[model samples]
Target: MRRKKQIFLSLGIAIVLLAVTWWVDLWRNTEATIQVLAARCDIPAGSRIEADHLALISIPASLNRAGYLENQELAIGRWTTGFLAEGEFITTNRLHDRARGLSYPDAALGRRLITLKLEPAAANGFWLAAGNHIDLFLIPHSQDRESEMLILEQIRIMAVLDENTGHRLTDTHLATTTGRLICLDLNVEQAGLILGRLGSHDIRMAVVNENPTG
Candidate 1:
């Protein structure tokens, strides 16, 4: 009789422990926040959100809550939870979209893509990578010609092509490549002006430093 009583007591304790654990897990899951992407206020789609414009908020228990939740803080440029799959908990601050000012001409319309060959000596040992901003230093020909070294600052590197594979180099090689064909973001007129003076003068690239304020 005593043995049977002891067995029942053990079973009752186990059930109580399981119930408490399940309840604790349910409570924690409810407390966790779900992140989503939305306007800082009300802005049109496709309009760029500046670094100072957008904010991040955390929602608890609900994935598709319409209104902003209380006690959630704005993680400036950190919550970019747009276009996420369902049931995913939004953690971390990498969800914010970067702000870029639109100022380039429509090169896809009728312009040509200029390929600038960077000599290994002048191209920082081919350490220059694509998507980096560079200053173009053009050493002009003699006075009989146009002997001047004009510097164009903040020219973006569009593509970095490889000579061997005839393919664009990936970001992995960006750190230590010896040669590259860098595409410049310039229109036909600007392209013509730069290319026309290429061979007559020395063409070198200078990496542009990021703005201190940014």
Candidate 2:
């Protein structure tokens, strides 16, 4: 009976010692360092990045020696770092930070702003939006004579405001009823030419299909 008790005590002591050793190893292993990306390295947009560009990400001590470690791959935007959400992969090809060419002429000071009113029959079904390029069609007539049509291509649509209230088209729901006042990015002289020709004939809008690279 005494021998049996001694054997049980020995087994319990061995189990305790094993548990302590495991706990120490677990604490030590919790100090692992992981790789994380940082954005302060002057990484410019459209610059390709690789794993080497990342900085080390440190795990908390509490999680270090848990016998399980997870390594994740991350793609971060330029000048950014950290674990990205799932399916959020970043690349240079997808970044479009460059200024659009259509908005260029208006960047100058003292630029002329011209409002062109479009009736439903004239405004291309009122399907125009800001930032769209259009070709202007004008019907011209000599006094008491049949009118001729003139086509001006490559005009820009600045805004589609409301004609009745003279307010900008703010609500999409009021679009069909508000009537459209189209702002054309034209020079003072050009605007005058188009406005003078408005009623003599008819005005129409056409979409301008420009090259994407241009």
Candidate 3:
């Protein structure tokens, strides 16, 4: 009877060892995963990151590294420092914080912000909004005897404002605001070109493209 009891104890010990081995192997083979934020679609450089532009994805924890954003709130309302491909992980270095409330865009750093006050009729009937690309035409004061010239093509609209209230309008607010003022993002040369012609020429704008890729 003692021999039978010892045999049963040995069998129990063997089963316990087997179960531990199996669990260790399973743990070793299963990869740990972590969630990170990624671009839901191709995001252009200098474009604002909206809620729809982000997605949460699970990846092997081994692949997770510092600077990767884990929260959506951290990305929304921020602007991209450079273009991000779809499914690419969002990192801290790739985003520019908008909370600084700078009068100019970080993406337009080293560039000039030029504001143009348009007549109610010249404001594209108030159809233009921020992020739209426009072409500017110059009517050369009729003194140069030159035909109307295309001064700028594909210039990005930085902001639309209600000239009367001096309030900036974007998205839904754009519909309610009378956008008679527009701010343009231009390089030094482009700003100079527009500034040189401003007083002498009657400038008109046309929306050539909307939300153009970087």
Candidate 4:
């Protein structure tokens, strides 16, 4: 009976030890380092990232397990969707398609989304999207002036519209391709300035944030 008791105790101890080892191994695996691509320099939003600007690094997988760039090819030929400091791991949300562009949230800090309708020649061939910084050029359609004047600069495009069809592109879809009006996000004072210039000056949308490489 004593031998039987000893055997049962040994079995219980072994089971406990096995369970403890499994837990430790699971913890270690979760904390394991994963290979990912990171920016080597300060890559600004809208800049086309290349291999020279990237480096493969091993990092704690669980630290930022979500949205990590898993391959070098994924990093190449993609635009930085937002500002990326040096040595920052490239994530899915941090990159964008080269043809398509980035869009931002609703304007904050005492700003409103102001919708402004401009001619096709004025709105940059319908390539406008949210988060695009634009400058409005007022070419005097009247007899007052022969030269072009800068009426508005650094205006943020909050939304776009298909003026003919009246569709609002909130998320920048195929709907924006037919978009004509580039909505501006601005303060009360700024809104007054843009609206006041409409009659005499024909406003044109120039994307100031177009790829610097180009």
Give the candidate number with the greatest lDDT. Answer: 3
lDDT, residue 151, candidate 3: 66
CA error at residue 174 for candidate 2, angstroms: 9.8
Select the stronger candidate by lDDT from 1 and 4: 4
Clashing pairs in 4: none
Once fitted onto the true fold, the runs of candidate 1 whose alpha carbons sit more than 4 angstroms away are 1-111, 143-146, 172-178, 211-213
- By TM-score, how accurate is candidate 3? 0.46
lDDT of 2 at 95: 30
- lDDT of each prediction vs. the true structure? 0.61, 0.60, 0.80, 0.75
lDDT of 3 at 149: 68
Clashing pairs in 2: 29-64, 30-64, 30-65, 34-57
Better of 1 and 2 by lDDT: 1
Q: What is the C-alpha lDDT profile of model 2 across 1-214, one tens digit per residue?
A: 9999999999999999999999999977866554333332444333444455444445454543433213324343233322333333233333333422233344356456788777776776667677778988886657445656677777877777777786666443333755678888876676777878766767788877657798
Clashes of 4: 0
Per-residue lDDT of model 3, residues 1-214, tens digit only: 9999999999999999999999998986797878899999999788899999999998778887665898999889998888799999999998997543334543456878888988755657667778778888777776654645646888888888767887787652333335468888888989888898887788888877544465
Where does model 4 exceed 4 Å of error? Answer: 1-105, 143-148, 164-167, 170-179, 210-214
lDDT of each residue in 1-214, candidate 4, tens digit only: 9999999999999999999999999988778787888888998778898889998898777776476886899878888878899988888888877734444457686675678776566677666577788886766777654545756788878777767876776654332345377778877877886677778667776788668676
Candidate 4 residue-wise lDDT at 32: 73
What are the runs in model 3 whose C-alpha is more than 4 Å off?
1-103, 146-150, 171-179, 211-214
